[model samples]
Target: MPGKFVVSITCAKDDTDKATVGFVVANAAAASDKDTVVFLSTEGTRLSQKGYADDIHEEGFAPLGELMASFAEAGGVIYVCSPCFKKRGLDEDNLVSGAKVVGGAKLVEFMSDGVSSVSY
Candidate 1:
């Protein structure tokens, strides 16, 4: 069976460095042929929006937008926290490709199986 990789990100533009690194790891997992999910919560939920990641780039790393697009191209999932998204008034229609607003139950279901998780 394939390995499952989960990356939980709780910061968005508020902490671009952490978010960028988290996606980099997630891309690596997906590139390794694992089932990868980037679970975005709190401030991180904002990243699910189209163009939100466009301006974020950390030194010595790929731009956040490019990393995100590559992750999606490599079959990674971006799970946005529903409540957090709504609380922040984000538009679901504008979510980036491969991203979906989901509840905690959805995350629980994904983690019900044996998996590795990292948080940022």
Candidate 2:
């Protein structure tokens, strides 16, 4: 039983609370020694950009940027939606340290083997 956790977030600053909580869950999963991946799509693709998460802070939670950093530091993977990123004209060079733009198939492959996933 491989403990793989997938947190799929479809909102970014547009829905700070959801995005913030998503990263929070990712952090927890990573800390618990689970293989964790955060799949960012739609507006959430913006979070893959360095500094885009910097100003997001939901009440009663750590700052969004800090949560994202912690999750990465804890060995969490961040998969950004390729098409969504390109649609917004985002620069690949500006991706955050642990984020990579990928097609949906990448995510499908990760979950194909069985995973626990939650969406925000």
Q: Report, for every candidate in turn, its global Cα lDDT versus the true structure.
A: 0.95, 0.93
Off by over 4 Å in 1: none
lDDT of 2 by residue, 14-114 (tens): 89999999999999889889999999999999999999988998999999999999999988999999999999999999998789899999999999987
Q: Which stretches of candidate 2 lie over 4 Å from their true place?
A: none
In lDDT terms, how accurate is model 1?
Answer: 0.95
Task: Give the alpha carbon lDDT tens digit for every residue of 35-59 in model 1.
Answer: 9999999999999999999999999
Clashing pairs in 1: none
lDDT of 2 at 18: 98
Indicate which candidate wins on lDDT: 1
